[model samples]
Target: MTKSLIDILDLSTGEIDELIETANRIIENPQAYAHKCEGKKLATLFFEPSTRTRLSFEAAMYELGGHVLGFSEAASSSASKGESVSDTVRVVSGYADIIAMRHPKEGAPMVASMKSLVPVINAGDGGHNHPTQTLTDLLTIRRKMGRLDHLTVGLCGDLKFGRTVHSLIGALSRYEGIRFVLISPQELTIPDYIREEVLEDGHQDYVETTDLEAVMPELDILYMTRVQRERFFNEADYIRLKDSYILTREKLDSAKKDMCILHPLPRVNEISVDVDEDSRAGYFDQALYGKYIRMALILKLLGVE
Candidate 1:
């Protein structure tokens, strides 16, 4: 009965809490678990280019005293020779004790997990979900604000294709009083399934709007995502909407002092660089928390005390 983290929903609420606690403990005393995974190995099978995610995973394994092996890009691996995901997983499983994979196709890692002998972590599957990132987000939110429940979380920009927002919303839905403000252009509004399935039927109080500043005062957590030019059907439309969503200092003047700003990296102009000096800006800290959470996950999966 091996558990695989294929989605954010794979872990129970209690399990999520435990992981957060473990991550905090590891963060406070890194040397305490220095040899936790001394004899273990982690394989990062990235089928896409992700400098941040790949480096964080490898750094996590290394910090836990574990060895790492894998291809960071699809073209560098057997996939370039036309090997199937299942075949790749089967081969990697024989070499590594656990696998963290990222693929551009939705459900590719799930298919790999079926044939894998070790636990398969979905790093980021297409425009789908990234469970590990969701975990990192949970850890960050809990540590920063001290509660996950009863918070007004605003998800802004690229909702139609932001995998982090999709995954975070799924995980947050299990909590209480989580009112969501989905802010994006008409073209980039949240998908219907998410709105209907998670917001409406899940009975969470939520609203959709294109005006970012109009909803800023109500948000406890402002989660920002990049509005990529590639998502638009027309270039002119992207140019028209890009600056409206960008978070400027003027917009934060009306926001609550305690409201925290978060972004899942490689940010374009969605967040202004000037906001980095704000005390509530947690994106950089979020990246550090990502490494800590990854270290905790590696230790847990490797069965190291």
Candidate 2:
């Protein structure tokens, strides 16, 4: 059977843990895994612009002594010439041992996976899912906090359209004693389906609030997200809500000294630069972990792990 990671739920809990364990081992023993995927190739079919995820995938493959090939944007690929995702993946599958794709349309990678012969990992699909980012978040929390369970995770800013938050929430809901403090503008609160279906169905505990300061004191981990101007249909709404939850040094004074702060990057001021100097700031470290976890992912998908 072929395996693809289009959603966080595509991997079982055990599989996710195994990936994290492999990632950690790779981090600690880089020399042993240097040639893990030496002869393989990864195709990064990114239809949308990406900084962190795209570069991280390339870096991961390179670190594993593998090669990477593909276009950074749809305009640079045959997609711009009207090639369908299925056609593109069908063709690329023959060239690369594995594929990590990001597309502006929701479920575009899923569509590619159906036609692809090799494993397809979803880098991001519209604002629908980014399983690899979720993996990075989970690994960061596990490595920093020493446990994935028994933590109050506060998801701040743009929850409604934040794919990382949605995927993280879904992944964390499977763990015991995981509480969610969803902090966002009322209009940007988690979608009803996620709140009702994922959280409620699992009988997990959660709270929704517009106030970041109110929840700062109670969080074990704070996952911040940018108010994406691209996600907003109205320019006025984007302008009004972009600064709704900036994390400042003053705000961190109320948080636990051991609390970890994480963000899926290319951040635009949701987190104040002053907060970067804090020991609790784990976003930069989280970005590093993104590469290690991705290396593990590529190795796994290519049957190298």
Candidate 3:
């Protein structure tokens, strides 16, 4: 059977841990795995604009000595000519051993997976899921905090449409003693489905509030996200909420010295620039981990590991 990573739920707890371990090994010994995917090809079909995810996937394949070919935007692909995702994947699967797709539609990758002969990895989908980013978050937490369990993770900013936050919450809930402090505006609260299905179903402990400062002192990890302007329906609404949550160095005065601060990157003003110099700021290191973890995922899917 072929495997595809369309959602974080597609991977079991054990599999995620195994991938993390593989990623760590790759980081420690880069030379040993340089040619692991030699002679393989990866196709990146990004129907949406991306900097970190797209480049990280390309870099991951290159590090494993695999070749990459694909488009960065929908305009550059046959989709611009009204080609369907299924048709796109069906065509690309013949050219590549594996496919990484990022689309604006929620289930675009899932639809592609149904038609793809090769492994299909979802780089991201329209505010729906970003499983790879979840893996990156888990690896970052494990490496920085020394464990995935027994942590109070504070998710600040736009939780409603932040796919990274949604995926991270689902992934972390599988562990023991994982608590969530959801900090966002009332309009930007986590969707009811996630609250009901993930947190409530798992019997996880979580608190919801619009206050980031109040929750700052209790968090073991602070996961920040930008209020995505693209996800907003109204320009006025986006303008109003964009500056609602900004993490400053002053806010860290109440936080634990070891509390790791993470952001999914391409951050607007949600995170103040002064926080970048702090030792606890792990977003940059988190980006580096995205490359390594993605390498593990590519290897796993391509049967190279």
Q: Which runs in model 2 stand beyond 4 Å of their true positions?
A: 228-244
Estimate the TM-score for candidate 1. 0.97
Q: Which regions of candidate 3 are displaced past 4 Å?
A: 228-244
> What would you estimate as the lDDT of candidate 1?
0.90
Candidate 1 residue lDDT tens string, 119-208? 888999988879889999999999999999999999999999888998899999999988889999999988899888988888888889
lDDT of each: 0.90, 0.92, 0.93
Model 1 poorest 10 in a row by lDDT: 296-305
Question: Model 3, 1-305: lDDT tens per residue?
Answer: 47999999899999999999999999999999999989999999999899999999999999999999999999999999999999999999999999999999999999989899999999999878899999999999999999999999999988998889999998889899999999987878999999999999889999999888888889999999887678777899888777668888998999999999999898778889999999999999999999999999998998775
Model 3 earns a TM-score of 0.95
* TM-scores for candidates 1 onward, in order: 0.97, 0.95, 0.95
How accurate locally is residue 178 in candidate 1, as Cα lDDT from 0 to 100? 89
Q: Which stretches of candidate 1 lie over 4 Å from their true place?
A: none
Model 3 clashing residue pairs (backbone): none
Ranking by TM-score: 1, 2, 3
Better of 1 and 3 by lDDT: 3
Candidate 2, residues 65-184: lDDT per residue as tens digits? 999999899999999999999999999999999999999999999998899999999999997999999999999999999999999999998898888888999999999999999998
